[model samples]
Target: MELYAKVLNYTMPVFLLLILVEQLAARRMGKQVNRSLDSVSSISSGMTNVIKDVLGLTISLLTYDWLVGHVAIFKINATWLTYAVTILVIDFKGYWVHRWEHRVNILWNRHVIHHSSEEFNLSCALRQTVSTVFDYFAFLLLPAAVLGVPVEVMAVVAPIHLFLQFWYHTRLIGKMGVLEKIIVTPSHHRVHHAINPIYMDRNFGQLLILWDKWFGTFQEELEEEPCVYGITRPARTWNPLKINFQHFWLLLRDAYHARSWKDKLRIWFMPTGWRPEDVKQRYPVYTIADLQAYAKYDPPGSSGFSIWAWTQLLVCYGLLIYLFAHLVTIGFSHAAVYGGFLVLSIYAFTELMDRNPHAWAFELVKATVGLGIIYWLGDWFGASQQYPWLTPLVGAYQVLSFFVSAYFSAAIRAGQPLPEAESVHQHGA
Candidate 1:
């Protein structure tokens, strides 16, 4: 866990640098591919995902080591060739798992957070899932097992596989010539993220484009039919945790409302977006019918509010880095507590950004608990032991965060709109 955390901490700065570069690239092209609150939400979602992964929240029912040990018919020696085959096999597994998530009803909940963003930008690439607590897809690595790829080699290659997918998420890079046919590029991924009829559920490959083409799920970026990013039903909020489990909650509601047992039992496994006939007519969820008419979720925020959001993101990010760096110092239990505190910090600030009237209440709870932790530990997780004055500073920051939240709460209650946001062009749903 410590090593994994360290690796992620090292890579995060590179990802942030790329995001800034993408912002400049977008400006040069006269395109605005990112909105402030949405970008914060996206980055915050990444923090949650990182914390969850570092904390080891998920269970893989089958282990790759066990699979290779039991199933390998041929042994490949550890060399550059073995690592090359390892990455290819990993992406091959990714293609099937990603395709399943898009096609299966219950499984879509595991992936919705990544697609909840309405814009296509480098920041949105960080909006990964925090709620995929159980996965049984290790068996999908059968090809690698057959080739006798060592488990140690895969452990090093898995993260590289995921990180390589990040650079292609930006709109700043256009279609690459020959590379587009070989690997997953910006054009291919944009289509994968699109909700347009022609683009829906296409391009399931991650590192390679071969899987999509071979499986007939490939959709080229059309000149006339522009790619419209996001799902058919917009997530409409800036909270990643809520968005993560949205599909499951909808399925539960539909199951409860269904009049027949058959519909109730089948709703969970039905194709993605399928609803019972009776429940569909009676309790229709909001889905964007015309992509051209739909407005993206861009709540008007004053400059001060935008700055506050950035501050919140930075503080959480700093705390996360500290947690990663000092996991041994703080011990495992306190690390979990620290992780929970960061989650609360994100939830409170983001709810406030959504202009929730009760956002102050969440802030209050978060602050109170934060103070309680500092008081109970008497050092804010060993910080005062080093700085001799940092614990009090943290306590004050907690109080200040609450006041800021309450201030925005009152402003929202007064119905005072912030300055108007710039106009947004709608893409396909």
Candidate 2:
């Protein structure tokens, strides 16, 4: 876990830099591919996912060591050829796992966060799930295990495979001529993220396009049919914690209200978005029926709110970096507490950005808790112990953040648009 944190500390900055480059390139091309709050929410979701992973929150149902021991059919020697084969096997398994998440009702919860963003961009790719507490796809890698692919090889390949998918999540790139036919490209992934009827649930492959093609899930980006991103049912909130389990909560509610015993039992395993007839009729969750009429979930906010959200995101990010740097010294309990604080901070600030009616109250509670923690610890979990100057710096930042949050909360309550907000509203009009 410590090793993973160290690696992420290095790679995350690179990912952020690429995202900035994509934003700049899109602006140059006269396209606004990112919304301020949405992009921040996406990155915040990524932070939660990384924290969950570094904390080792997931439990694997089956051990790969056991699989390699029991089912080895060929003891392939480690070579370049063996490494190439291992990657192919991993991609194949990824395809099935990705397909399963999209096709099954229950498993969709684990992946819904990724698709929650209304915009499809590099930032959206960072929107991963924290609700996936179990690693149930270990059996999917049985082919690799049986081939005598060492667990160490998989450990080396897995991060690379996931990171490789990041570059393709942009709109600045068009379809590559021959590469589009072989590997997953920007165009291919754009189709995957689309909610269009023709494109929905298609192109589930991560690295290679072969598995999607072979499995009949591939759909090409059509010139006639432009891709509309996001899920059919919109995740209306910017809070990643809420978005993470929104689908599962709905599923649970449906199961509880379901009349038939069979319906309750099968609802989870059934196709995505399938609900019991009785529950569907009674509860009636809103789903998009007309693609043309659907609007993106953008709440009205001033530039002030955007600045506030961005500032909070940066502070939360700094906290995460601090936690990662001191994961060993702080120990699990402190890390967990710090992680929880970061999640709450993200949730509170995002709620404000979304212009929620009760957001001020939440922000108040969050600020109080944050100040209390800082006062209690006297140094942001011992950062001052090493860099004594960080104590006053963090202290001032927290005090300033509270005032900013309070001011925004009052402005939101009063329904008085700041000058920057009024300018934004007029510009949009």
Candidate 3:
């Protein structure tokens, strides 16, 4: 089997299990709990994105197509000693880069996108910078290629490193007694996600936690304190572009206000939202009293609509499975078909859930039925035999149905009413 097949094998079952667990967890939470089809779809999409990055790198490695500098920097001699050393060096480099992502403003601009979601689960791990691969290879792979690391060895090690980190992103695992001293554990990573002042800027390990312990950044997990995780400022929306660029935009604006070149550089490299001494920053720290006095944007709870939304999601997924199997049978490209189907399914399911919660379930079943009808038309009418072009048309129709379903889901999210704005009593006004 191809490497892609292996990755699929490793990833799909994890996602399916998480989906089931999340549904149960949501039910327990009640009050329109966070877990839904959108949640699972997000995780699946994230995995696909990660896989794309790996595929790109794998192709370059197999074809010996990386830059001369990259080849030299990431090169290894392909011996056991070299393999061991490569792992250590790459891990050490990852430690500092991971740490810098949390500390530096420009980097944090990219990193904050991952932390924007308040809900933490297996899917949250998949949320990442697509450009993360470029940045990672640029810095980390330089040494390996420079040293003449066999591309094959580096290739195997890199994905293994990544695959090892996958389960660490979940909420399921607790502490590992002695293992916690060596490699990163889920408990240690939860600390990294916490917004608590004490926990901030700690635990930057990817695979090995030893770097943190050696560098004095390690703090043992504290059950009593409990982790309250999320970014300091919430993203509050799901637009991927905005999630990626919001902090970047703010950084550029603040850099413009610097009194000197040094301050400007500092503004970009320092933690996000930093200012020079001459500049005064406005802080919005809502105290307990203040929160009680004015609490807009706070809804009581979700109406009883998630069940209907979920029904639609399940139906869409069922059709996706059938369509994928059919596409494979017809010799249509699995890479293109599966990739497109997954993206469309996620967007459509999200749209339906957000649009009309009451009709969401019915619409999902209806769409699935419509797909069956189309498949029957192609088969019974002998469209493939008569027109031949009708086959592609049916595929096109599937794509269109995906988009329409997505629109409905988005509409549902927007339909919920927001709190009223407060009146202003400015002296001038």
Q: Which parts of model 3 are misplaced by more than 4 Å?
A: 1-6, 18-34, 37-41, 44-48, 51-83, 131-147, 256-266, 273-429
Candidate 1 structure, TM-score to reference: 0.95
Model 3 Cα displacement at 82 (Å)? Answer: 4.9
Cα lDDT of candidate 3 equals 0.56
Q: Write the per-residue lDDT of candidate 2 for residues 189-213, one digit (tens) a residue.
A: 9999999999999999999998888
Candidate 3's TM-score reads 0.65
- Candidate 1 per-residue lDDT, tens place, 1-429, comes to 888999988999999988988888888989998888899999999999999999988999999999999999988788999999899889999999999999889999999889999999999999999889888899989999988888888999999999998988988778899999999999999998999998899999999999999999999998899878888878888988888888889999999999999999998888999999999899989998999998988787876787778877998898798889878889989999999999999999999889998999999999999999998998788987677776887788888888877877887888976432221111100
Q: Candidate 1: give the clashing pairs.
A: none
Q: Candidate 1, residue 93: CA error in Å?
A: 0.4
Model 2 segments more than 4 A misplaced: 73-77, 418-429
**Candidate 1 backbone overlaps, count:** 0
Candidate 3 residues 1-429, lDDT tens each? 145444555565676676467557656766232454335435534544543453343222223236333446443457897788668767877788788888878778657756655555666666665434345333455566567767577666765676666566655567988999889998888888876667878899988999999998998779877666566655544433345577776667666765678987788777654666654343232222321233222222233334333443454444343343343343334344344444445444443433444334543554464466456554412445555775565555455444444444444567644211121111110
Better model by lDDT: candidate 1 vs candidate 2: 1
- The lDDT of each candidate is 0.88, 0.87, 0.56
Q: Any idea what lDDT model 2 has?
A: 0.87
Q: Enumerate residue pairs that collide in model 2.
A: none
lDDT of 3 at 415: 67
Distance from true position, residue 213, model 3, in Å? 0.6
TM-score between model 2 and native: 0.94
